[model samples]
Target: MTSFNSKKSLRRVSFISLSFLFISSLFIQGCKTGTKGIESGSNTTLEASINQGRNVFENSCAACHSFERDGIGPNLAGLTRHLSTEEIIDFISNPKKVIDSGNKRAVNLQKKYKSVMPSYSMLGKEKLASLVSFIHTYKDVPKPVDINEEGILEDPIPHQIEKSNFVVNLEFSFQIPASNEELPNTRITKLWGQPNTNEIYVCDINGKLYRVKNNKPEVYMDVQALMPNFKQRSGWATGFGSFAFHPDFENNGLLYTTHTEPIGTKNADYTLPEGLSGQLQWIVQEWKTDNPKGKTFKGSNRELFRIDMATQAHGMQNIDFNPTAQKGDKDYGKLYIGIGDGGAVQMKFPEVANGKHSPWGSILRIDPTGTNSANGMYGIPSDNPFVNITGEKVAKEVYANGFRNPHRFSWTNTGKMISANIGQHNIEAVYVIKPGANHGWPTREGTFGINTQESVRKIYKLTEEEMKDGVTYPTLEYDHDEGNAVCGGFVYTGSNIPSLTGMYIFGDILKGKLYYADESQMEAGRAIDFKEMRIALDGKETTLLEMTNNGHAKLRIGKDANGDIYLFSMNDGKVYQLVSEK
Candidate 1:
């Protein structure tokens, strides 16, 4: 037996010795390409290790062992009071060694159980230590008692849990005429309009922007011609991605568009790093519409910023200015850019010089009008989460991080910024983006564990304390069985649909499954259960199969100047407005 102080010293020494062994295991096991950022135990304290241990226990041991009562194995709640931490760790790591050596207590226990405890030596020393430490922390505390079977909720809204009966109908607005043989590439990816304007600006993934007036679409900008190599590897997910007209578009004629461009001298404002390997770069260009009342762009433009990306798959996807933010507000006139992780699983922390951040896998906020950065092109807001820090782990331009692919984000009139994060495998997440908060990625997908050596989708549970530090969980999440991808929509503030006025309207991209939930619940820091809104056409309830023709309709939720919402299909090229069922 050893004293607590002596064991603490020994634990430190063991942690130091475990580093070389852990790195060697990566080589021996042939490290998975995307799982390189799993937390290493170098700086872990006993408390932190115990948290890791709790995760391991839930994943591997909880099924067989119980803390209160014997399940398939002996009770583990107070095992520390009966056995020393060293003995428990040793026995769990190599039960066979302890039992086969004829150790009297180990042999007697094995005989009584009539089952051999499998050696968990492969859990690695660090994890194993963590697991034991977690178990050791449970001394005499009683297991928590749940009074209600459904569990107590904070500010629970009973109506939100009930299914919604709102019925929506799809009215064919117009198709985004295909420029080529591709079925979906030239279809409308986004439909946007500004206040006091009757015209709607629609853009496609093939580098084309069109102005829709009187249900007719006319070419507004030929983005494909602006880049020579865009057509080489472009599809429905690339090309001229999104566009945003400034809040004061009528006064300044300022507009912005994000496009995928080749990384070399074609547009010479930026260049690829000497050894950078990505073919295309995601860039934002500021354009002055020669005539604000005219139908087409006459080409007065300047480059705002560019990120040389490796893959065009998740390259810069969407951008928008905060519409509700006013003149004296902190967020006024700031453009929010949604950047993906460039088809990679993680991002580079301790951001590099020049404040690109991951530039990938982040939601960036920048002042397009100010010229305070080193490049003197765009300004980093003074209050941005990572604004003034230099040579530190944070990025000056990063507003919030830990996003895999934030396809779309919108602000409500109440100032809640909601983002839909496309998930990797099991689940899709919708988060309320907060400054300096991390919506877990690579490490987590939705509420599930996303990075594990054994499986990418294995669940990793976090403790309450860990969640409060820097990690932020989703406001709503659903498994893959519910929908494939989440299409972010706005919080309904329109008057036409009485039932949906205060509800958030969002849908699935692949299935066209529409859902709405009360925003007040989430705004108050409580998660609300979502209910799928059934779509009815021609006096009959229908599924996506009936509405979309096939099951492949790509659905997008759009908003107009009046804050009225509509749904668009990239597959069939139709737009539908939500109305009261007649």
Candidate 2:
């Protein structure tokens, strides 16, 4: 087990050896040194270049690179309109060289988007020029006048996340193995506990399943090695998404997992409508282990279903079997899948996830043991919210609808369901979920009206008529003033930290700031207050931001077998256990 501390000197290395290989490969490929092939003003050449460039961008760059909107990568729509092809090529060929020379644009881009700009040098001049040519055709649209400048909350929460009396002292546990040397070292999304089996599993989006023993991580399963078509490279949320062990895993060896594959790898159960392109497919699968008591996964796996996603931003996360449910309870053994809008609305396909009929933006409940679904691979719960809906083609598996990036959801002992949603440009939210609930997205963001047709960054106070439109608003929310993304956490019901009981702990993914709300006080139709919880490392005060290998903290919250919260920093691949005392 390795302890974590501030480490900046080592991490500043420029993309390490990967950038070197990218440059070396480009040098060997050889090309016109000064952008000779780019015919920026020729309409005839633009038409001819579109096919190759479009195909390349759609397949290779669509995962993170976008000309439309900025997420992980900067918007490239107006990229070439301001800069010359020579300057673009020079920067793409070597961003570090340009940045080192004090180019303000290159320096700013690096600081803003982090490692989203890996060396494009490996694409060589032909592909690079073609990619640039495709981007050049789409000029940036002129900005629209603010429709609701006065209505928007410049800082939604108004005040900073206040420090509470509670101090969450952490003890550093083992670091999850670095799957790759990329910026996000390990996409450690979930740390799940199976009570029956008394085992805790940590899932890395990079395809590894780790079983924690004492303070160390041991590989229990390797999805990348098992599934030939499995990939995490195409998107940040690609790879082994989430896993769920059967409530009776001690008696039954069943485990469910979600992963992503390149589009067209297999026919999908959920696909985009006519003319709209779906970039990737998310696969939900089940595995039955040969030995139920084994330390490693030796199993036979089968697919339950697959769905096409518009972009990789938000598709599937944190499948669950209600931990609080008993054997005879209605929720027992039923798997709940937190599905996002798949960037459909942001990708200009808003209608795809607009209602109950579409599975894109929904929380689905199903029985994995029975085969009654349309695909005959899984069973949709008969009592699900939409199963009996008439006069409409509804996805019966939908328990709730109208969420953009429904990252994680969990149930408390009081039977209240809570969820955290990743916002677009304005609010990061938490909602008390109920069946058939519409936690508004793409339209209403955290009690504010968002115009999907216009810039999503703009939000207006809801009109009187829009307020009564039956959309359930967020129970707790924060604006981008303090952080970037929300990493939903669980209500700490564990015994180790009695003071943390009923305190729903969560954090900002980008800023690594921690906050919590009184889960016991959270209720539907009513907003609750949340506050920042301070952190200490071995009796010394510290912030998760400073503890990361790089400054950026892709923070994820996890629960151990005892229900204790564990903090995962994808930046450093380290796991820190939150305790009442150091």
What's the TM-score of every candidate structure?
0.68, 0.82
User: Candidate 1, residues 311-372: lDDT per residue as tens digits?
Assistant: 44556778999888877888888889988765433221112112234456788888899898
Q: Name the candidate that leads on lDDT.
A: 2
Clashing pairs in 1: 340-361, 350-393, 449-460
State the lDDT of candidate 2 residue by residue for 1-582, as single tens digits: 011122222111001111211111122112334334466657887777766666555544323334455333434454544455665666667666756776444444443333323455556777666766766666673222222355445555567667777577898877889876555667788887767555678988888999987767899999988999996742257789999998887778899999988888988887777555666789889999999888899979999988887666678976988888889888889999988987667655667776677887888899999798888999988879888889967788888888888898887877788888888767889999888988887788888887777655567777778888898888889886677679898888787777778889889887788998898788875887888888899788889878883435779998866778889877667888888843
Please give the RMSD of candidate 1 to the true structure.
17.0
Model 2 lDDT at residue 329: 88
For each candidate, the alpha-carbon lDDT, in order, equals 0.62, 0.72
RMSD of 2: 9.4
Q: Residue 124 error for model 1, in Å?
A: 50
| Candidate 2 global TM-score | 0.82
